[model samples]
Target chain A: MAIEHSSVDLSDAMILEPTALADWIITAPVIIPLIAGALLLMIRHETRFHAGIAIGALLLALLGHIGLLARVLETGPLTMTMGRWLPPFGISFTADVLGASMGLAATLSALVCALYSLTDIGARGRRYGFYGFLMLMMAGVNGAFITGDIFNLYVWFEVFLISSFGLLVLGSERRQLDGATKYAILNLLGTTLFLTATALLYGALGTLNMADIARVMPEVQDSIPAGTLATLFFFAFAMKAAAFPVNFWLPASYHTPRIAAAALFGGVLTKIGVYALLRTFGMLMPDQLTLLSTLIAWVAAATMIIGVMGALAQTDLRRILGFVVISGVGTMMAGLALGSVEGFSGAIFYAFHSILVMTALYLLAGVMNGLAGTYSLRTLSGLYTSHPLVAAFAFLLFLAVSGLPPASGLWPKVMLIRASIDGGAPWLAFAILLSSLLTMLALGRVFLLAVWRPAVEPSTAMVVSPGIGYAALLVLAVPIVWMGVYPEPFANVATKAAAGLTDTSAYIRSVFPEVVQ
Target chain B: MQTLIFRTAAPYISSLMVLFSIFVTLRGHNEPGGGFIGGLIAASAAAVYGIAYGVPAVRKALYFHPMAIAGSGLMLSALSGVFSIFHGVPLMTGVWGSFGFLGATVDIATVVTFDLGVYLVVLGSFTSIALALEEREDG
Candidate 1:
């Protein structure tokens, strides 16, 4: 794909240039999914067609996102001002390397999840509404990453939350309903806190723009009563990210959804919270971050240990994976606490890796449930015999999650550990290593029970659709290995993105040059 | 007699409430009223309609599906942010233009457009949930 750069001279009276056609790449990822979602709603009667269109839209989104990421990498950050208004007043859509890369990861995961749903859920029942909800959720996740405004982030959160509510309850089982209520209440509380934080930030600074806030923060840091507000904001994001002490709702709520839905939720949702935490701390309040870093580090350690313990106790495959997601959250945060470039890059790279590995693991679990007629560990056995492909894919993902060599997970763990050691926090490094061990143990238990054990009743077998299952597995599996093997490009981009976030000077200059005044 | 009162009072009250919601949504940018409040009002209207009439009856009267409304609202709100492009502004930048109408100056902008979108989305989502739960109970 050819990358185009456009610049309109703003040396005249206006502070910024109007948006050009080049801006389309920034907004297209959000707009396309939404348009597809609206189109799906119109054809609610045609279940298969809706599912196909939804999947196609996600595929197109994934491709388009890659193209956009290429453009951002070739150029610097790709920014499009809304309605052509300048930075302080209007909302901006930024395709920074980090945001675009996350968007790409999310879109790919959604695409695989969509495909898996078509086979798994379609076999069980017709759910056109579910497809529609899935599309909306995709739009929310994409938009949240790319948006340059805090309030816009909140809106996207609601967009995703509303659809998630629908997906969580689509099964209408009693457990699903109960879980949905708890999920709904907790998420609502989180969003409300997020909204209030936005309001408080806006009130403090008179601006809601992320770049603009970064510019203004230093002047106000001393007079603005920073610590308390910062704590509130941290708590709010931590709740959303499902950090320790606030993470109970995730495992409780996630396991009740249909496996396909649960896979997407596990893969994409918590990352948004983590993304927000990283963006806010790294960009908006870097000065105060030092104070909070210790607290955040402890949270990461606790979340990691607690998450694995929770995973070890789970008898169900989906629930166990859900808890594993919780544990991995700590690993991702460890990089941020180290507060070094290597640590930050490792954290971000690990985040990207976790998105793929977790989704693949969950997708494999969904396939297992489809084949074995149950997700219970007691009921499932010896999938290596009948479903060798599924077994192989599951084992690959298990290795990836365990941070074993030759897989994507190992590199990020290595980088994080190195960063921890360099930062003189060997204890943190040890905690990460310990967490990895527990994760290995937790996943090892699952692999043994799900893949190695002999099937108790060969007669009671559920037929797995080889075509879709293999396709879905390949979709995620390829990236897991490719990224693991050749991670330099991603690492380079992540380093630049992290630097851009930390320096804040490039972001500030981009939004407000000396000429603007 | 109570049923008669509900029958007599519900439609007018519901209609008035929806109209008020529109008012709140339109005025949201300058003042406190906006899409969220408007959506709540409209959802309340739907609930009252549900109670006065049967849930099925209310759902039938809602010609547009709730989810569709919510989805469209989301699109509209997002589009409002994009609208800033026309005036050479960034996304979600507020733009205002005024025209004289009916011996008064009338102003319109993307923020109001966004609020209107929010109204539709909130109304659609809340009402859909209410209607779904009502249907479940009926069954």
Candidate 2:
């Protein structure tokens, strides 16, 4: 049935259309983690077995995503409706190149984190459903990336939040409980805002399918309370993304959890918020986005400055990394604010690059925590002597995180800067460069204090054995260097993904097939 | 201390509620009663029984941890989708089949399986949480 809302143009309406190629692969990335998580909960006492299952499930999903990415890149977007129903009536799972690539990156990060958890997560944490919650969080991230409906996105967000809440409080320490309380309260507020926006949008549009909303947005752009809806969406996603003025929850709570959970959250969680922002503003409301580009640019600049300044003041390794992740969000937001093809492509590439780099950085932070028996920089030192490999990986990831040349982070910054100049927003470019400079100083201070200086007390001894976790960290580093050395293939994929986002007619057509006579 | 009269009636009342919950779950295919509501009904029945008997009694009756029930439900829900792949449909797409037993015809679909999963997951997770809280109070 066609949505016959008065605001929708007859020309834009499409009748009940069936999907062409029902690719089950489009849904596997989400379902695999979900099923694995459920199974992990069943086998809770078998810690080693749970670890194996978690890592295996993530690897399977990663492979599935790789194949799905290739297919989507080759044959446009893929769409499938649940329960064999048509698009509007059923929940639709649609994955374009962007979604597939993001899914791949997230799954890869999760796999590495799971591998690290083998050594890191204690028996108590394992008994408390660590792997289950981790897998659940991964499932939520993948589901959010692939779903084609707004309400479905909300459901996935809740899934992400609930699992993350459990994972955050896995240890049940006083600190963890405190962190979880703040995290749960703030995140729940964001969720409430999101649900409010969804209710309002559905009330106005009479449709919850994203493609249908995008098709009808132009018609109702002026008639409805578009600005308020847009603002609500912006705040909701911004709170989740940890953008400036609403990012305190991240640094506060992120450091309270164990390294594995922290690494997963650092890598994939907030990025989902960024992905949602791109999908909603970049695709669903291009006209409004164009109108608000200047506002977004200022917000981007402020987010970059505020986030870096926040990082500069932090002494805890995880907290510093947490703030750095926020700055990375600013960089991506800058690209999005530019609202150009080059800008969008830069944002997409940076999104994936940041995922890998931040996850690697956090994993290295875990190794550092092992080396010094704490996460505080004041108590950490002499890592270059005792554990050279961990120090080396941390240094390299820092360079990548701060956008130094010959690192993956530099390429995205270059594209974003170039786009800003061409798009007549050089100030945004300057904001990015300034943020990178400040981030370098902040992180460089971390390096000097944590790596160069001698230990505050030479009597402090290293804690645990660095097993395959170090290898897992190094494996994540290889892709960062690979992207830096050979940026062409990655750039091409990102450009295609950006093109798909800028033009959603293919996505719309894929999800809502042409109605046959 | 257990109230003799309430304790005496709890078993019969709880058994009926659980049976009613299953009926509600089965009718959810075309009616308003689905897995979530049915599961909540079942959990409340268990909670009422626990109030009369004790946390230990409810735990013994459940046999498996409530969280395990939730996990199994999740697996069932997800597996229902995987089954659709074998039928050459998209993920989570419903595939229907019919069978006759005892000279009566029975219809089944993947959606029903998914709903049953949801039911178990809700019933188990909620009851477990309630039991945990009630146990904490006792301790």
Candidate 2 chain A, run of 10 with poorest lDDT: A11-20
Could you estimate the TM-score for every candidate? 0.88, 0.95
**lDDT tens string, model 2, A281-306?**
88887887787778778888888999
Per-chain TM-score of candidate 1, chain B: 0.90
TM-score of chain A of 2: 0.95
lDDT of 1 by residue, A1-517 (tens): 0001116443343444455656577877887788788767655666768877887888788878988889877876776655445567757776777788888998988898888886767623344488888888898999999988889889999989988998898868999999999999999999999898888888888998888888889899898867776787888888888889999899889989877788889988988888888888878887777878899899999998899999999999988998999988888888877777788888888888888888888888878877888888987888889778887887788889989866789888988999999998999999999988998999899889888888877737557666776788898888788777987877887787788778776566655655232
Error of 1 at A230 (Å): 2.3
For model 2 the local lDDT of residue B105 reads 86
Q: Please report the TM-score between candidate 2 and the true structure.
A: 0.95
Model 1 TM-score, all chains together: 0.88
Scored by TM-score, the top model is 2
Candidate 2's C-alpha runs over 4 A off are A1-22, A515-517
Give DockQ per model, in order.
0.31, 0.55
Please list all clashing residue pairs in model 2, or write none if there are none: none
